[model samples]
Target: MFAARFHPPMASAPPLCRRGVPSDRPAAKDPDAPNPL
Candidate 1:
């Protein structure tokens, strides 16, 4: 059954990445702005 397959304790979960950086909002007409490619 599905319940038996996932019944193990979840204490071994991997750590999550939380290093988010704040970005500046570029103007709509900025010719030198980097493309979001």
Candidate 2:
């Protein structure tokens, strides 16, 4: 399952990195979540 662990963070990192805001925390938690961006 080690690869699975990396996958989640890798997938989440893109949106958070692009947004570069604390709001990304929630957005990353919920992919369907809407963002002002």
Candidate 3:
């Protein structure tokens, strides 16, 4: 319940990172590290 605000920022962060400008946004590293394929 208290995490409501975090949820939106979490979703928005990834898309913004993909825009290329935020290439250094640590969040992007998490997804790529697990999918070595």
Candidate 4:
């Protein structure tokens, strides 16, 4: 669960942050929803 909590920000922090400017909250939220391995 830590990975789920941390990985997305670690992986998508830049893109997420970039999109966050335009309110792309879902983009970040989407990753957390997936149990991608």
| Tens-digit lDDT track of model 2 for 1-37 | 9999999999999997778775777668677555433
Per-residue CA lDDT of model 1 for 1-37, tens digit only, reads 7666555433223221121211222443253455542
Instruction: TM-score each candidate.
Output: 0.21, 0.48, 0.47, 0.29
lDDT of each: 0.36, 0.78, 0.75, 0.73
Candidate closer to the true structure by lDDT (higher is better), 2 or 3: 2
Report model 2's TM-score to 2 decimal places. 0.48
Task: Give the lDDT of residue 23 in candidate 4.
Answer: 68
Backbone collisions counted per model: 0, 0, 0, 0
lDDT-better candidate, 3 vs 4: 3
- lDDT-wise, the better of 1 and 2 is 2
Q: Over the stretch 1-37, how does candidate 4's per-residue lDDT look in tens digits?
A: 9989898778878887777676666765677568463
By summed lDDT, the worst window of 10 consecutive residues in model 2 runs over 28-37
Candidates ranked, most accurate by TM-score first:
2, 3, 4, 1
| Model 1 regions more than 4 Å off | 9-37
